[model samples]
Target: MSSYPTPTLATARLVLRPLVATDAEALFAVFSDPAVVRYWSAEPWTSVAFAEQAIARALDSYRAQSEVRFGIVLADTGALVGTVNLHHFFAQNRRCEIGYALASGHWGRGYASEALEAAIGYAFQGLDLNRIEADIDPRNGASAAVLERLGFRKEGYMPERWFVHGEMADTVNYGLLRRYWNERP
Candidate 1:
């Protein structure tokens, strides 16, 4: 896949940038909350070590040009609220998967959508990707709605796709094409 520098993206209320080591504490605070990771494939983080390790991995991935994970922050307060990432790249197909998580307290405020929109824009314009995909637990209606609002269509479903924390979860797949996004209002 093509590698591009992680640019700082801005929206009306949020900023999307690469993760930093100093963000460990704030990252821990967001990921440790069970409510924030209810639909995630992994359990709630129990330690700051996880955040530090994750930051290290992100740095490695950035260097390898394999994935780009942005730490979503409030533009005004400069507080880290969550993360949105474009990963699982398919260079031959010009495609990748989009994923994100936000603190529960920040929900209902459109932060996730704002950050995701910026990421998707970058993927299409900066990386020259043609398609982006999302996989969500079927029960995550809020996430599904966000994808739909961004012009991603429900493409397929897979039963028992993930075994997370002893639960066999179904996945609802969504996809957005460059043409579709370009036509979006």
Candidate 2:
């Protein structure tokens, strides 16, 4: 059986669910925006084809029992504003990495934090995970703030860990153990 089964998760204003091929256009728009993906580990997606392939890869990740990437849908309009993810599942260690990217237009609206809270709750409760880690570029203060608010503590840092946008950047690692996680259903 797959360790990660995509489930419908709901919050006050958003629904976290599996991405489908039909969501390609909307997802592409979110990913194609440079501002949205500036701090992302990967470069900005440039085509709808990439979004389609990404959805396929997400399913493959679940099939392999390694990860889950859920599209964050607005509860009222059902518009896909972003994605919340738990990846690099380490079953033996009972750990995983959590991440997200929201459409630029949705920034400062509390969407990412709300969606991530629900996703992390799923990791700790639904999946029985022991720890969740987040790696962010040290310069991305906004993301750092979100991680901090979610009760993740800075665990470490690696200098020049990633080469992005033609430059090297340091990475800050934050972590939260199930015992330390504060959010609840």
Candidate 3:
């Protein structure tokens, strides 16, 4: 696999940058909320320590060339609203997966869409990735709509791909190709 760089990216109203140690408190506020993490693959974080640990791991993974995650910060308030992640890279195939968790308060406001669109652009144009994929909970209509608007087509559904919160959860897989993305309206 090729080592890719994680550089800062800016959208109209948000900034996609690396998470820092100082962001722990704000990160905890977002990840520890049950509502924010309700549909996420991981359980709601219990403490600020979780955020600290996650940031550290994210940085380490970046150095290890395995995964990369960006902290979603509102440009105006300079608040850490959530994260946009692009990981599970396959350099040979030019494919990767994207995931995110925005603060519940920021949902319905297009922050996730803006950040994701920027990230997708970087994945394709910057890293030269040909394909980007997302595995979301089928129940998440909001995420489904976002993916659709971004030109990702729902290609498959897995009945029990993840065991979350003591239950078998389904996954809706979405994909977008470079050629299609380049021609997106």
- Most lDDT-accurate candidate: 1
Tens-place lDDT digits, model 3, residues 1-185: 58877889988899999988999999999999998877777899988999999999998987886777999999998999999889989989999999898999889999988999999999999999999999889988999999999999999999989987778899999999998888887
Report the C-alpha lDDT of model 2 over 123-151, residue by residue, as the tens digit. Answer: 98899999999999998999999998888
lDDT order, best first, reads: 1, 3, 2
**All candidates' lDDT scores?**
0.93, 0.89, 0.90
Q: Which ten residues in a row have the lowest lDDT in candidate 3?
A: 33-42
In TM-score terms, which candidate is top? 1
**For model 2, which pairs clash?**
none
lDDT, residue 19, candidate 2: 87
Per-candidate TM equals 0.97, 0.94, 0.96
TM-score of 3: 0.96
Error of 3 at 111 (Å): 0.5
Expressed as tens digits, the lDDT of each residue in 1-185 for candidate 1 is 36756788999999999999999999999999988888888999999999999999999988887898999999999999999989988989999999899988899999999999999999999999999999999898999999999999999999999997789999999999999999998
Model 1, residue 10: distance off in Å is: 1.1
